[model samples]
Structure formats: C-alpha cells, structure tokens
Target chain A: MSGTLPSDSACYVYGIVPADAPVPEEVLGVGDPPAPVVPVQHGEVAALVSEIDPRRPLGTPQDLIGHARVLDAVAAGRTPVLPFRFGAVVRDAAAVTDELLAPQQERFLAALEGLEGFAQFTVRGAYRQDRVLREILEQRPDVARLREEIAALPEDASRYQQIRLGELVSEELTARARADADELAARLGPLAAATARADSSADQPVNASFLVAEDSWEEFERAADGLAATWEGRIDLRLLGPLAPYDFASQLVDARGRDSWD
Target chain B: MSVAPRSSNYMSRPSSSGLVDVIDLILDKGLVIDIYIRVSLVGIELLTIDARIVVASVDTYLRFAEAVNRLDITQDRSEGLPQLVNDMQEGGARHKTRGALEGVKEKVTDLIGGDGEEDEEEQEERPRRRTRPARKGREQ
Candidate 1:
C-alpha cells in the first residue's frame, strides 16, 4: 500500500495500532470524497491513514468529526490505538510508512501494548452557578456587604462598586473552582491507572481525563455516580468515555521513550 | 446542570456531537508524531483564538456587575434583608441572575460591534462530516 498514491495527495493519519489488529471496516476518513481508511504496516505496527488533498483547509466541523470518528471506531473495535493529533498529514503513504511507521515502530508497539486494555474517560464538572454564588455569599461577609451596597445604589451611579463586586465575585469563583477541582481529582484518583487534568475554563470547575483499565470501568462509573449524587445541585457532572487513550498515549511516549512501558 | 442519571452499563458512549467536545478531543488531546507534517487548520485556529478573546474581559466584568445590581430590583425589597437573602438562595434567583447576565453579554457584544449571531450562522453553514453507522445498542 506504499508509494502508489499521487504525490499531491498526502496521507491524513488518524492513529497507529498493532499490524495484526483488525481494521475497522466501516470507518471513512477526512475529505469531500471521504477517503477510504486503510492501514500501512511496518514491523509489528501499522498506521491508520487515508488520502487527503493537502491544499484544502481542514477546520470544518465535519473534518473534526471525521478525524474523531476514525479513531473512536478503532478503539470501539477493542484494538489498542495511539491516536494522532488532528491534521497530521504526510507527503504520501510512503512517507507515512518510512518516516512515521518504520522509525517509530518500536515505540508505537510498546505504547500500544501499554494501552492495550485501557481507555480514556473524561469527567467534566461545572458548578451550578447560582449555588456556587450563594455558597460564596454565605462564606464571605465582605462580598455580601459589598453586593448589598451596590444593590442599594442607583444603576448609573454604582459603576465603581459594580466593578469591585465583579472583581470579588470573579476571584471568589476562581478560588472555589480550584478547591472543588482538587476535591474531585482526589476523590477519583484511586480508580484510574493514571489521571491528567485538562485546562479549566471559567464555568467548568473540573475537567479531567482518567486512563482506566477496562476491568475497573464499572467500579469507576459507580464511584463517579456516587460522587455525583453527593454533590447534586452543587456541581453538574458529565462522564464521557471508553475512548481512545489520547491524553495518556502521547504523554507516555514523550516522557519515557520505548523502554519505560516494559 | 444536574448530572445525568447513571445507566447500568459502565462503558458510556462518547458525546461527540457538541462542538466543544469535538474541539476538546480533536484539537487539544491526541498523539503527536514528531516527524509528520502538521497541517495548518485555518478555521480551528481562528475559532480557538476568537473564543478566548471575549472571556474575562472588562465587558464581562461590567456585565456581571450589572446583573448583580439588577437582581436587587427584581426581588422583593419590602421583605426584610434576611428574607431577600433567603430568596436569593432559591432556584428563582439563579434563573434571574443567569438571564440578566446573558442579556448583558448580548448587549455588550452588540455595542462592541461583534457579530455573535453571524458567527453562529457561519458555524451552522459548515458542511456536516459523515460518521460511521451507529453500532447496535449504543445509539443515543
């Protein structure tokens, strides 16, 4: 499957897996024609790839979905996959095999083996804005007093007070969010093989990914459900997973090299 | 936002439909092969950069402040101060505050000549990418 495609058509790589692993038959890759997904092998590892027009801009929602779909499909098929970052394109299948698959075969094989029975589960928690604000007001008398003072003033005249109130609220929210995120991480830490905290946004207090062994998935879910019940009305929790170990795979490959996994 | 009730199965299907979920997984989390070419994704770069621009700005602070001030007017002033605090603790207060904040956000965006609706429209107009057929028993 190498060196046959036109040079103008590059291979858009989705991920890499063991060469013996079954290719997900139904998956189509990124592009207007929706390039046929195929595997190019080197040693024990193979790259999941498809042809793409290199010149086309690739940020459309469809393109994003297409990239994710291919990777997710591989994971769903029970094969370990090391997903490539979206928009990973190469000159052609030959380059994919020679540069990506051949040179990195050992590392890829090790990473894939390490991730064999694990999948990524992302747990996102956002505060019920109102409840959090209420909690803050109850905790901070100064902020509550300031809020009252601003409320008493004329709308047009309370500009400085409004700014102060905004600053205080923002600060308090950040602090509370930090505490809550830590609490969540601590609670969920034992259930996973490894955990990584995702970048937090304003509303989301807890954005974390856990690399979980497939056997422990039930235990993890039950624990999460219990925590959700305990924090009901305070934090809204959403769990997404059984996904490709995207967050962990890249980190492991970079941090320890091929020998670390063994 | 209440948590969805736990289903019996442990391996929940991924929520890949929302734009935020897609961006979080695709752009931010994935394996990086050092030797390969990284394609310049024009729209993603633009969207991610633009999304960060409006957050935590002076406009957002003023809006938050304004919303707090408006909260006093809509609630019962006749009742004692403690009663007012009690009322704010309830869900009604949340809805009012959220609505007020959202209103201010829209107004501030309009005042700054930002076309929020046009961005949404452009996002909607982008062609839908095809996905694999839903696996049995996992359809949502």
Candidate 2:
C-alpha cells in the first residue's frame, strides 16, 4: 500500500520513471489478490513495482491489462514512463535498485527527459467491406467479366476464374493500401514529432502510431476525424492515444515490437 | 460545440478504454531487460496470433470472387442487386476467416486453461465509456 516495503517476496516490475514520478495511489498491479504498486527508487530513476508470490507465474490476460493500466495511467497523466515488458520480476527490492536501476540510471534518465511532455497515439484504418467491393467491381472490367463468367458456370466449374478474380482484387487492394498509407502518413506525420507504422493489409490500410506533444492532442484528433469523415462509408478510421509510448520507446532497448508499416 | 454529428462508422477513444485496441502493444512491445525474471513461464504458451486477415490464398481468392459475384455493379444506384447484396453479405460472412488470430488473450488463456479472447475482448463497450455504435458492413 505504500512505497516503502518489507524485504521478503519478489518484486514485479511494471515500468521505469524518474525517482519522483507520481504513481496513482491504491493502484493494484498483476496478481490474483493484486498487490498495491510501490516505487523502488535509485537516485533519479525508479521502478514501479509490487510484491508477488514466487509460486505464481504472470501471463494472464488480466495481468497483461493490469500491467498496461498502471503504465498507461501514468502516461495518460503527467509522468512520462518507459514501459518494461510484462512478466519482468527481480528477486527483491534491493535487486531492483542495485541491479536494474543503478546499472542503467543515466540511459533511463535521458529517455525519460526525451519523452517528458509527449505520449503515443495510435491510428487504425480499415476498409469497409461493402463499399470497397463495389469500387473494385466498378473499376475493373476484367474482374466484372470474371464475376459474370463464374456465375454462368456450374458452382464448382469456375474455380480458376474465381482464384484469378480474387488475386486481382488482392493486387488492387495492395496498391490502394500503399497509396492510402502514404496519404495518411503525409496528413498525420507533420503534426507528430515522430511517427511509426504497423503492417498494413488489404482490409486494414493503415496501422500506425504517433508521438505528439500533450498540448497538441486536440489538433491531431481533429485531423484524424476529418480523414474519417472523408472516407466515412468507405474506410473506417479510429484514433487511440495518450498511450505509454510503446512504439517510439522501443528504441530505448531491444524488444519484440511490431515490424514497420511494410 | 467542437463536435458535430458524425457518422457511426468511426470515433476516437482513450488508450485506457479497452484491451482490444492495444493488446499487442502491451504484450509484444516495451523495454526488455536481459537481467532477471523469477516468474516461471514453464507451462505458459506464447500465442503470436496475427489478427489481420491474410489476403493471399486460394480460399481467400475464392471468397473474394464469391463476394464480388454478389455485387450488382453495372446497374443504377437505387435499382441494382436489390436484396441480393444482403444475401451476398451473408455468404461472405459465412466464410470470413479469422484463421491466425488468438492474440495475447488467447496466449494467456492457454496459460490459465481458458478457451478464447476473454472478457474485455468480447465486450464492445465498457461502462462509463461512451457507447460505441455497432459497426455497419464491418468484416466480421
């Protein structure tokens, strides 16, 4: 319940922040009977932690949410955090200070300063099935002809044309997705200090994240909504943000983050 | 008011709003220290479920062909396909493949002896959050 703790059970590490970072009170971290999060500080860096029983493992869906909720709540507020991968734990509070924080205090401090006033926001845009299908059919005569040919033939006879039509649609979708992703980057890129994208599919054209100054959040959301309005019935776009910089901060250390928007 | 009447297709939500939005970021991302971890992941399985639709395959092609087969593309706007579009939609829905997706929830579900995308993933809207309209014509 308090930052100060008894030296017994292992410490479950959630994230790293400045020593004085304000953790929300009564916030419980990963466990069945969740333990109250407490800070273990070393000079300017601190690890947000809670005591956990060594007998139990930490990989439950709720545990993942709990871990993220703690870090994201901090990110959503004022304090900037470098989120540690879930399931990170050290033997005791001393190990958190001596082994974790003390060894890399300067690197952690610099990363925190770099991210002091910013948070991560995500953009996901998926093509509406009905509308996109109509566009494809209208534009490609070959595709339309193939559709008709398949319809006239027996249910199983037009298998080759069916595959051919699907392949063409897939090709067209890939090209369109590339163009849309570029347009999306051009629109949202300037507003963000930095940007990173996730893998795009024919169905979902853009999966991206932006690092924006906290004060400029309203402006960014405005642009996203505008894009959504433009493609309202064609492509569905959603904005999620004030996140814990999971994308941008991947550079701080080697982690299994998502691949680029390719 | 800064907000005007917008369509039901899209909207923005906070990062804390739901697990569906950031599940991958929470699990696959963040800083990893090679130093120490005492928690035993002995029986826990890592399910790297790709939720995105795999667009290139004979089956997907067949589905796409079938979906296009339903479109009444050449006719006038209000007069074409009629209710045939609905039938095509049902046909496509019947074959919509979510083949690879099991996600962090499924991985953790395996660890705890559960079956699917658990509580938060299934709920479209959580209490105290704004109600999300059911997505129309969404790929199920």
Candidate 3:
C-alpha cells in the first residue's frame, strides 16, 4: 500500500496585497492540508506562500475554504489584494519574489490602486417559477408547446432524461433572464462602476456582480428599489457588496505575465 | 468561469441584498502570476477535476424538464410561457448555440485557494467524482 501511494511536493501560491506593503505574520494559503503564509516580496507586492504537499489534490470545499480564508483574512485587514489564479505555486520564496513578484510589480501596484477605496457587490436573482411560468404561458403559445412537452415527462426518469430536461428548462429560463437583464441593467447599470455577468446556475437564476463606488451605496440601494418596482415579482434581485473588488478585478496580464490588478 | 444553466427563473421578488452571487465575485476574474520559481503544486490535476463539474447528462435534462413542468400557467394569465420563454430564450439559446460549454471553473485557490488538494486521507469525506448536477444544483 505504501509503495502505491503518490509522493507529495511543496506547492506555493500568491494572493492579495496592498502596494508597497509589509508582509503579515499569519498569511495562509489554500487547501485542506493548509499551507502557512510566506511573503514573496517583489518591489512593492508580496505573494502569499505555503509549503503544500504536491501529491495532494486541491479544490475540495475545504480547499476552497482555505483559499477564501487566506485572501479574506488579508482583505479583512484592509489589504487590497491581487488574488492569484487558483493552483498557483512556485518552487521557493526567491523565485516567487524575483521571477513572479518583482517583474509584475507595476501591474500589481496598478491593481491595488484601482481597487483602493472601492468594493464589489453581487446581485443574484432566481426566476420566480410560479410567476414567470404563469407569465410565459399566458404570453407565448409557441413556448407553451415546449413547456407542455416537458410537463408530460414522468416523475421517475433516468439520468439522461433529466439532463435533457434541465437543458430545455435552462434555455427557457435564460431567455427570460436576458430580457430581464436588459431591464435590470438599464436600471442598475448607472449605479455600478463596473460589472461581471456570470452564467446562471439552477439555484442562481441571474448571477451578476457589480463593482460600485464605496460612497454611492445608498444610491445603489435606491436604484435596486426602482428596479424591483419596475420588474415587480417577475424577477428577483439581491445585492451584496461594500467588500473587496474581487469581481471587478480583471484577468488581463501585462508583458511581465502579471495580472493587471488595476 | 462559464455559467451553469437549466434551472428555471424565479417569480419571487428580486432579493434586496444579493450575497448569493458571492461565488461570482470570488471564483474567476482574479489575478494570477508565475512568480520566480513557480511553486510546486501537489496534485493539481486532481484538484482541477474536482473544481470543474460539467453538467451534460440525462439528469440535467429531467430537472430542466421538471422545472418547466412545475411552471403552471393556469394561475396568472397576464404573462404567458411564450413571453417568459422568449425572455429566457436568449439565455438558454446561448447554452445550446455556444461551443463554450465549460462548467464551473473555480479558481478556488485565490479566493478559496488553499489546502483543497485531495490527499488519500481526505478522499473519504469527498463525494462521488461525477456529481452530474444530481437534480439539485448549488443554490445561490
């Protein structure tokens, strides 16, 4: 049994930081087999480090929690972080600082700068099935045929049957969401500084995160109120923010291979 | 990070404080750089697999069908299925039309990136590798 076991290697990663900041004593990195925070200092930014056993698999709920914990912990302290892509690890601290961190200093600095004093807000809504369906059937007979066909399926079915059904329903729902998005965006866009649209999940009918200015929170809420009135019960809207600008952060990298944080 | 589809839209009033989309803020769209000597990750191949769960089986279809069935039109006549389906059509249509069917690519490492690496000892707690969206997708 021991012979069959895979070998573990140390995994290193970097996470959010303020510009030209000192490393924190208790920096943590992602995984169930948690890694301690090691600061990989480039000119102004630092990559969080941990000695991870390379043989282990990452991305379990615990790993997700581990990742969130480290960044959240740092962000909570008001450190504007340039979050790294998950599964990022380096050989050692020196390489992390020189090759990874140093070269990307400008990008990191810019990212930190862009996010300063601003935060991210997430808005999610599920289709009010009862209301939406009623509205849909009343409005379009063409869709009704499809809906009627879906209704005819048995309660107990195979896995294959279910995926197909999910696909159809998802399509119908997305159609409604797109229109709803137009109306919602019209009302909500002005309130946000930037936005990222995400694919909707079964539970999350409309998944969108908005980057809003810190001072304009009240106005943002008011705008949501107006949207709620306009859409009524047809669409649901939820907002969460005044936190780190995680969503607004871009994935574009500069010449140095560092992400453009700003 | 591509979005998942199939769950029907809701009729309830939009939530005032939408924290459920929190996953969106953290998942993708962050920064990643290869600093100096790239840190040696453990079993990343396994980790990525765990994070990326694509829904493309019969189960997805049935659930979608179920949600569609559940959408009763007898109650309110103001809005019909066609109009609602039309609204959702763009969203769902894209699902079928686009070749980009990559499901849930979690960059859990940065936002939730840490010790998620699967080791032999932790396998017991982990659920089946093929979760197939199983009737219920992650609720917002």
Candidate 4:
C-alpha cells in the first residue's frame, strides 16, 4: 500500500524562502500518508513543499502541528518564509515558482526582511476564581441574588443544574472580562509589539497573542512580569512564544496558495 | 487625534505579538485563497462543532435551579434562615468561583472534548433517553 502512493497529486506548498534557507531535504507534513517536503526554487526564493493527497483529510491536530513544524524549522534558520495556511497546496513546482514565488517577489522579500530578528508572544488571561469571585461579590449586587440562589442548592444534584449555574457564572464573568479587556490592554499595552484579541465566548477567558521584537524580548518579558505582579492573584496571565510569527504573518489577510483543507 | 489614537491603539493590540496569537490570525482570520488544494481531514469538522458551546443556554438555568435546591436541603443545625442565606451566599460565591474555573475547564474540554460538556449539552436538549455515549461522540 505504501509503495503505490502517487509521486505528485496536489502538494500543499507553504511559503517560499531564499534558496539559502537551511531546511532539511526531508520533512514530513500532515496526514497518515505523510507528505514530504520538496524544495522548489524561484531565483533567490525556494518553497518548502509536501504532497497534498486530496483523498486524505486535512486540519487534524496532527496535520496542524505538522504545518507549524515546517515553518518553525525554516523560521529558526532566519529564513524569511511565506507560511501557507494549514492546507495550502499548488499544482506543482512550476506553479509555486511562477505564481507565488514570482509575482509576490518584492512583497515576500520585504516581509522576510521585516520579520527577521522578531518573534511571537501569546498572552492568555485566566480569572483566578477565588480572587475574581471576591471581586465579583464586592463589585456587583445582582450577583448577590444569583449567589443566594446558588447557595440554596443541594450538593448532590443533576449535572444539568451544575451546567446551568456554570453558564450563569460564565456570563457574569465574561461581562466582567469584556470590561477588563480595556484595563488589561492599558496595563500591558507597553509590553507588546502588536496584538489581536480572539472571542472565546463566555465560557473561556479572553485570549490574545502579541508579536514582540526579538531584541525587545526582555522588555516584553518584564512588562508581562510587572502585569503578573500587579494583577497577581486576580487574573492568571500566561505567555507563550518567541517562536515564529505565526500570528502576525502577511497571510493574515491574503491567500498565497490553495490546499485541500480549504 | 482620532487617527493617531486609533493607530496607537491598533499598534498596542496584542495581535502584534505574533507568537501567542498565531492560532487565530493565521487559521481563523487570515485571507484564505481557495485555489490551492488544502488537505481535507475528517475529524476537523468536529473542532468547529465543538466550538459553538460557549455560554448561556437552558442547560445553565436548570443547573442554577438545582444548586439552589441542594443548598436549601443542606440548611440544618443552629443556623437561622437569614444566617443560612448568608452561608448560602458565601457558598454561592464559592460556586461562582468554581463556575468560572469550570468555564475555563469547559473551554478546554470544548477544545479537547475530554470532559462531558457535550453530553451535558445534549442531555439538556434531549432531556430523556438516559443514554450517554451517543451524545458524547456526536463530532461536528
């Protein structure tokens, strides 16, 4: 079964890098069938590729992780790469060279240059239930009534009741989180280079990621440290990365290529 | 002034930090050109199906009712109604705290579905049947 795989169906091609990028000759991308990276060069830029099997499904956790690994490997070497979305594929090397690597030459080059010496930072806000509860009790009166209602419930009840109370708490906290987002920004505003807030609904706390300059890593870290100290037990602030600029890439609003997952 | 303020505000937006926020800008918000063939995965539709369980539904209201009843049942000893109400309020505060933690936990579960948030949601909708796994495995 393994021997019968096609040499080329439609391979999902991620972004192109300068030919000098020190990528391994073989790196596997998403799926059970294991897509292999083949380099396709256009002048100075080269694309990192793996075959996209239309038959095989995409966007699984494994596949997404695979996508990140390739970009990370290239990005680590200071290669200015154009990262395709999770499932971007092209017809062949010719298409990659002609369409993406060629037409977008100037933009890609500039972006690569711009991204050098920079890394990404993710900040997730988690409410310290104990502290947040205290704050909520002190801050809101309506919450008092809801508290009274919740107090009257027995310990051993249906899971439905538990979820219902969970929903109310989520709603109230989410409202508070929305209000706090501005304060959060005000507090940590000076710490990051760029930022984006994702809507995680009421159940989840506000989630945001920041892109920080590699040189300013200390400043970013210190700012996060200060906020962590100030907020202390009220909200749990967690940060991840200095890794690839996956969040702030040019692909945020433009499509470089197509893949099966789309 | 507005332009400067907004630009400054935009710059201050954490989306600037490309690392932590990579998940959203690239995957959900980015410009996706349709021509390139993306690998089609089977289970990913489940991810979307799982995302919609964020907040505020009948499931929550019923839980509120039940909690209130349970707290009522626990009222004994020397505590009067007012004192018991006060204690219940404190318990309620604790519950709210638990609920918030539960909210984040629910978010993680919604992402991984390791917990039974899905089954609970389905039970609220369906209400009877007593079966669990059917609701558990309904991947989007």
Clashes of 2: 0
lDDT of 4: 0.48
| lDDT per residue (tens digit) for residues A1-25 in model 1 | 4443344476788898899988777
Whole-model Cα lDDT per candidate? 0.61, 0.63, 0.49, 0.48
Task: Give the better candidate number (2 or 4) by DockQ.
Answer: 2
Mind giving the per-residue lDDT tens digits that candidate 4 earns over A77-137? Answer: 5455657655665555566666666766665565666665655556665554445544555
What are the clashing pairs of model 1? none
Per-prediction share of native contacts kept: 0.26, 0.37, 0.42, 0.09
- The lowest-lDDT stretch of 10 consecutive residues in candidate 3 chain A is A253-262
TM-score of 3: 0.63
lDDT per residue for candidate 2 within A1-262, as digits (tens), equals: 1123333356788888889988757665687678899999999989998877655645545566677778777887768898887667676777778777887887788788778878888887666565777787789888777788888999777788888987898778777877888888889888888888766567567778898887787788888888877777666677766778887775743322222211
Worst 10 residues of 1 chain B by lDDT: B45-54
Superposition error at A189 for model 2 (Å): 0.7
lDDT of candidate 1 at residue B122, scale 0 to 100: 31
If ranked by DockQ, best first, what sequence of candidates would result? 3, 2, 1, 4
In model 2, the Cα lDDT at residue A96 comes to 79
| Docking category of candidate 3 | incorrect
Q: Write down the lDDT that model 1 would get.
A: 0.61
RMSD per candidate (Å) reads: 11.1, 9.1, 10.0, 11.8
DockQ of 4: 0.09
The runs of at least 3 residues in candidate 2 whose Cα sits more than 4 Å from the true structure, single-residue gaps closed, are: A1-9, A53-57, A253-262, B1-10, B35-56, B72-140
